[model samples]
Target: MKLESNLPKQSPWLYTAPLLNTILLLLVYFLFTSDFVVQSGISVEHPESNSRLTGFDRAHIITVAAGTDSALYFDGLRISQPELREKLKANREGERRAIIHADKHAPHGRVIEIGNMALDLGYEVAYSTVPPKS
Candidate 1:
Protein backbone atom coordinates (compact mmCIF):
# COMPACT_ATOMS: atom_id res chain seq x y z
CA MET A 1 0.00 0.00 0.00
CA LYS A 2 2.83 2.43 0.91
CA LEU A 3 4.84 1.64 -2.26
CA GLU A 4 1.81 2.09 -4.49
CA SER A 5 1.10 5.48 -2.95
CA ASN A 6 4.71 6.61 -3.45
CA LEU A 7 4.76 5.65 -7.15
CA PRO A 8 2.83 8.05 -9.40
CA LYS A 9 0.53 6.70 -12.10
CA GLN A 10 1.68 9.26 -14.66
CA SER A 11 3.77 8.40 -17.72
CA PRO A 12 7.29 7.22 -16.88
CA TRP A 13 8.64 9.58 -19.56
CA LEU A 14 7.02 12.48 -17.81
CA TYR A 15 8.89 11.63 -14.65
CA THR A 16 12.17 11.88 -16.55
CA ALA A 17 11.53 15.12 -18.40
CA PRO A 18 14.86 16.70 -17.52
CA LEU A 19 16.84 13.60 -18.40
CA LEU A 20 14.86 13.15 -21.60
CA ASN A 21 15.46 16.73 -22.58
CA THR A 22 19.20 16.39 -22.04
CA ILE A 23 19.39 13.20 -24.09
CA LEU A 24 17.28 14.74 -26.85
CA LEU A 25 19.55 17.77 -26.98
CA LEU A 26 22.65 15.58 -27.18
CA LEU A 27 21.14 13.53 -29.98
CA VAL A 28 20.27 16.69 -31.92
CA TYR A 29 23.80 18.03 -31.48
CA PHE A 30 25.46 14.88 -32.78
CA LEU A 31 23.00 14.61 -35.62
CA PHE A 32 23.58 18.16 -36.80
CA THR A 33 27.40 17.91 -36.73
CA SER A 34 30.23 15.42 -36.76
CA ASP A 35 31.98 16.02 -33.52
CA PHE A 36 33.70 12.88 -32.13
CA VAL A 37 34.56 11.02 -35.30
CA VAL A 38 37.81 11.46 -37.26
CA GLN A 39 38.17 10.36 -40.88
CA SER A 40 41.69 10.47 -42.33
CA GLY A 41 44.78 8.49 -43.32
CA ILE A 42 47.29 10.58 -41.42
CA SER A 43 49.91 8.80 -39.38
CA VAL A 44 50.75 9.22 -35.71
CA GLU A 45 53.51 11.75 -36.19
CA HIS A 46 52.18 15.26 -36.59
CA PRO A 47 54.14 18.08 -35.03
CA GLU A 48 52.05 19.68 -32.32
CA SER A 49 52.27 23.41 -31.79
CA ASN A 50 50.95 25.62 -29.02
CA SER A 51 48.05 26.56 -31.24
CA ARG A 52 44.49 25.73 -30.34
CA LEU A 53 41.57 25.43 -32.71
CA THR A 54 38.31 27.21 -32.06
CA GLY A 55 35.87 25.16 -34.14
CA PHE A 56 36.93 22.44 -36.57
CA ASP A 57 33.57 20.86 -37.21
CA ARG A 58 32.55 19.37 -40.56
CA ALA A 59 35.12 21.23 -42.68
CA HIS A 60 36.22 19.92 -46.05
CA ILE A 61 38.66 17.05 -45.61
CA ILE A 62 41.59 16.53 -48.01
CA THR A 63 43.95 13.65 -47.53
CA VAL A 64 47.38 13.45 -49.12
CA ALA A 65 48.36 9.82 -49.13
CA ALA A 66 52.05 8.83 -49.06
CA GLY A 67 51.69 5.16 -49.95
CA THR A 68 53.53 4.94 -53.29
CA ASP A 69 54.09 8.66 -53.80
CA SER A 70 52.63 12.05 -53.02
CA ALA A 71 49.09 12.24 -54.41
CA LEU A 72 46.27 14.66 -53.82
CA TYR A 73 43.02 13.22 -52.53
CA PHE A 74 39.76 14.98 -51.77
CA ASP A 75 37.49 12.84 -49.67
CA GLY A 76 39.21 9.75 -51.13
CA LEU A 77 38.82 10.96 -54.73
CA ARG A 78 42.06 11.58 -56.60
CA ILE A 79 42.05 15.11 -58.00
CA SER A 80 44.53 17.50 -59.55
CA GLN A 81 45.29 20.93 -58.18
CA PRO A 82 43.12 22.80 -60.66
CA GLU A 83 40.28 20.35 -60.28
CA LEU A 84 40.52 20.71 -56.53
CA ARG A 85 40.29 24.46 -56.83
CA GLU A 86 37.30 24.24 -59.15
CA LYS A 87 35.54 21.88 -56.79
CA LEU A 88 36.21 24.10 -53.84
CA LYS A 89 35.08 27.17 -55.69
CA ALA A 90 31.82 25.49 -56.56
CA ASN A 91 31.08 24.18 -53.10
CA ARG A 92 32.48 27.10 -51.15
CA GLU A 93 30.93 30.40 -52.11
CA GLY A 94 30.95 31.61 -48.51
CA GLU A 95 33.50 31.24 -45.72
CA ARG A 96 34.78 27.69 -45.59
CA ARG A 97 37.60 25.71 -43.99
CA ALA A 98 39.82 22.79 -45.01
CA ILE A 99 41.59 20.09 -43.09
CA ILE A 100 44.74 18.53 -44.55
CA HIS A 101 45.79 15.06 -43.50
CA ALA A 102 49.32 14.36 -44.70
CA ASP A 103 51.63 11.50 -43.98
CA LYS A 104 53.93 12.08 -41.07
CA HIS A 105 57.05 11.64 -43.15
CA ALA A 106 55.68 13.30 -46.26
CA PRO A 107 57.88 15.99 -47.73
CA HIS A 108 57.20 19.46 -46.43
CA GLY A 109 57.11 20.87 -49.93
CA ARG A 110 54.19 18.69 -50.98
CA VAL A 111 52.16 19.57 -47.91
CA ILE A 112 52.91 23.25 -48.33
CA GLU A 113 51.85 23.10 -51.94
CA ILE A 114 48.48 21.72 -51.01
CA GLY A 115 48.10 24.21 -48.19
CA ASN A 116 48.93 27.08 -50.51
CA MET A 117 46.46 25.83 -53.05
CA ALA A 118 43.71 25.59 -50.47
CA LEU A 119 44.54 29.06 -49.22
CA ASP A 120 44.47 30.35 -52.76
CA LEU A 121 40.96 28.96 -53.06
CA GLY A 122 40.03 31.11 -50.05
CA TYR A 123 39.69 28.27 -47.55
CA GLU A 124 41.22 28.35 -44.12
CA VAL A 125 43.79 25.56 -43.78
CA ALA A 126 44.09 23.35 -40.76
CA TYR A 127 46.69 20.63 -40.30
CA SER A 128 45.55 17.37 -38.74
CA THR A 129 47.75 16.52 -35.77
CA VAL A 130 47.92 13.59 -33.40
CA PRO A 131 48.93 13.58 -29.78
CA PRO A 132 52.55 12.68 -29.10
CA LYS A 133 53.15 9.10 -27.99
CA SER A 134 54.32 8.75 -24.43
Candidate 2:
Protein backbone atom coordinates (compact mmCIF):
# COMPACT_ATOMS: atom_id res chain seq x y z
CA MET A 1 0.00 0.00 0.00
CA LYS A 2 1.22 3.51 -0.86
CA LEU A 3 0.00 6.84 0.53
CA GLU A 4 -0.18 9.89 -1.81
CA SER A 5 0.98 13.31 -0.60
CA ASN A 6 -0.85 16.49 -1.57
CA LEU A 7 0.57 20.03 -1.40
CA PRO A 8 -1.33 23.27 -1.86
CA LYS A 9 -0.24 25.59 -4.64
CA GLN A 10 2.13 28.36 -3.75
CA SER A 11 1.98 32.10 -4.57
CA PRO A 12 -1.35 32.79 -2.92
CA TRP A 13 -0.88 36.43 -3.92
CA LEU A 14 -1.59 35.57 -7.58
CA TYR A 15 -5.18 36.78 -7.64
CA THR A 16 -4.24 40.35 -6.78
CA ALA A 17 -5.18 41.96 -10.07
CA PRO A 18 -8.91 41.68 -9.57
CA LEU A 19 -8.66 43.07 -6.08
CA LEU A 20 -6.26 45.77 -7.23
CA ASN A 21 -8.50 46.54 -10.16
CA THR A 22 -11.50 46.69 -7.90
CA ILE A 23 -9.70 49.07 -5.56
CA LEU A 24 -8.57 51.20 -8.48
CA LEU A 25 -12.02 51.28 -9.96
CA LEU A 26 -13.53 52.26 -6.65
CA LEU A 27 -10.99 55.05 -6.24
CA VAL A 28 -11.69 56.31 -9.72
CA TYR A 29 -15.43 56.03 -9.24
CA PHE A 30 -15.31 57.98 -6.01
CA LEU A 31 -12.94 60.51 -7.46
CA PHE A 32 -14.99 61.02 -10.57
CA THR A 33 -18.40 61.13 -8.90
CA SER A 34 -17.41 62.99 -5.75
CA ASP A 35 -16.30 66.64 -5.88
CA PHE A 36 -14.02 66.97 -2.89
CA VAL A 37 -11.94 69.86 -4.16
CA VAL A 38 -13.12 73.31 -5.13
CA GLN A 39 -11.64 75.09 -8.13
CA SER A 40 -10.48 78.62 -7.56
CA GLY A 41 -10.83 81.85 -9.63
CA ILE A 42 -14.29 81.09 -11.05
CA SER A 43 -16.89 83.67 -10.00
CA VAL A 44 -20.31 82.37 -10.89
CA GLU A 45 -23.11 81.86 -8.47
CA HIS A 46 -24.02 78.45 -9.83
CA PRO A 47 -27.76 78.44 -10.09
CA GLU A 48 -29.57 76.63 -7.34
CA SER A 49 -31.31 73.42 -8.26
CA ASN A 50 -32.45 70.11 -6.88
CA SER A 51 -29.52 68.24 -8.43
CA ARG A 52 -27.12 69.41 -5.71
CA LEU A 53 -24.04 68.59 -7.75
CA THR A 54 -20.68 69.78 -6.49
CA GLY A 55 -17.68 69.63 -8.87
CA PHE A 56 -15.18 67.49 -10.82
CA ASP A 57 -11.50 66.45 -11.17
CA ARG A 58 -9.10 67.48 -13.94
CA ALA A 59 -11.48 70.18 -15.13
CA HIS A 60 -10.63 73.48 -16.78
CA ILE A 61 -13.20 76.23 -16.46
CA ILE A 62 -13.46 79.00 -19.03
CA THR A 63 -15.52 81.87 -17.75
CA VAL A 64 -17.21 84.05 -20.35
CA ALA A 65 -17.96 87.27 -18.62
CA ALA A 66 -20.91 89.50 -19.51
CA GLY A 67 -19.29 91.79 -22.04
CA THR A 68 -19.28 92.63 -25.73
CA ASP A 69 -15.77 91.29 -26.37
CA SER A 70 -16.47 88.18 -24.32
CA ALA A 71 -13.05 87.98 -22.81
CA LEU A 72 -11.81 84.56 -21.62
CA TYR A 73 -10.44 84.00 -18.13
CA PHE A 74 -8.82 80.73 -17.13
CA ASP A 75 -8.02 80.47 -13.44
CA GLY A 76 -8.33 84.24 -13.07
CA LEU A 77 -6.00 85.10 -15.95
CA ARG A 78 -7.02 86.51 -19.33
CA ILE A 79 -6.07 84.24 -22.23
CA SER A 80 -6.47 84.44 -26.00
CA GLN A 81 -7.96 81.65 -28.08
CA PRO A 82 -4.63 80.26 -29.29
CA GLU A 83 -3.17 80.48 -25.82
CA LEU A 84 -6.26 78.85 -24.36
CA ARG A 85 -5.89 75.91 -26.68
CA GLU A 86 -2.24 75.58 -25.78
CA LYS A 87 -2.95 75.72 -22.06
CA LEU A 88 -5.68 73.10 -22.30
CA LYS A 89 -3.47 70.84 -24.34
CA ALA A 90 -0.61 71.15 -21.93
CA ASN A 91 -2.81 70.61 -18.91
CA ARG A 92 -5.04 67.82 -20.16
CA GLU A 93 -4.15 64.14 -20.00
CA GLY A 94 -6.62 62.57 -22.44
CA GLU A 95 -9.51 62.11 -19.98
CA ARG A 96 -11.09 65.32 -18.76
CA ARG A 97 -14.40 67.03 -17.86
CA ALA A 98 -15.09 70.74 -18.24
CA ILE A 99 -17.97 72.88 -17.02
CA ILE A 100 -18.85 76.11 -18.77
CA HIS A 101 -20.34 78.99 -16.81
CA ALA A 102 -21.36 81.74 -19.19
CA ASP A 103 -23.42 84.75 -18.43
CA LYS A 104 -26.96 84.14 -19.60
CA HIS A 105 -26.59 87.19 -21.83
CA ALA A 106 -23.23 86.20 -23.24
CA PRO A 107 -22.80 85.01 -26.78
CA HIS A 108 -23.41 81.31 -27.28
CA GLY A 109 -20.34 81.11 -29.45
CA ARG A 110 -18.21 81.87 -26.43
CA VAL A 111 -19.42 78.80 -24.58
CA ILE A 112 -18.95 76.66 -27.68
CA GLU A 113 -15.40 77.87 -27.95
CA ILE A 114 -14.70 76.76 -24.42
CA GLY A 115 -16.22 73.34 -25.05
CA ASN A 116 -14.19 73.08 -28.22
CA MET A 117 -11.05 73.81 -26.31
CA ALA A 118 -11.79 71.04 -23.82
CA LEU A 119 -12.66 68.66 -26.63
CA ASP A 120 -9.41 69.42 -28.36
CA LEU A 121 -7.75 68.52 -25.09
CA GLY A 122 -9.49 65.12 -25.13
CA TYR A 123 -11.58 65.79 -22.04
CA GLU A 124 -15.11 64.60 -21.38
CA VAL A 125 -16.83 67.93 -20.97
CA ALA A 126 -20.13 68.69 -19.23
CA TYR A 127 -22.01 71.96 -19.37
CA SER A 128 -22.90 73.41 -16.00
CA THR A 129 -26.54 74.44 -15.93
CA VAL A 130 -29.18 74.92 -13.32
CA PRO A 131 -31.25 71.76 -13.26
CA PRO A 132 -34.93 72.31 -12.71
CA LYS A 133 -36.40 71.04 -9.47
CA SER A 134 -38.06 67.70 -9.84
The candidate maximizing lDDT is 1
Instruction: lDDT for model 2, please.
Output: 0.70
- Model 2, residue 12: distance off in Å is 58
User: Model 1, 48: alpha-carbon shift in Å?
Assistant: 4.7
Task: In model 2, state the lDDT of residue 133.
Answer: 60
Q: What TM-score does structure 2 among the candidates reach?
A: 0.55
**Per-model TM against the reference:** 0.63, 0.55
Report, for every candidate in turn, its global Cα lDDT versus the true structure: 0.77, 0.70
lDDT tens readout by residue for model 2, 1-134:
99876977868578887899999999999999767554546555444455554555556667776668877777668888789788777774543666666766667788787887687778776665567666
TM-score of candidate 1 versus the correct structure, residues matched by position? 0.63
**Clashing residue pairs found in predicted model 2:** 96-124
User: Which portions of model 2 show Cα errors greater than 4 Å?
Assistant: 1-42, 45-58, 92-95, 131-134
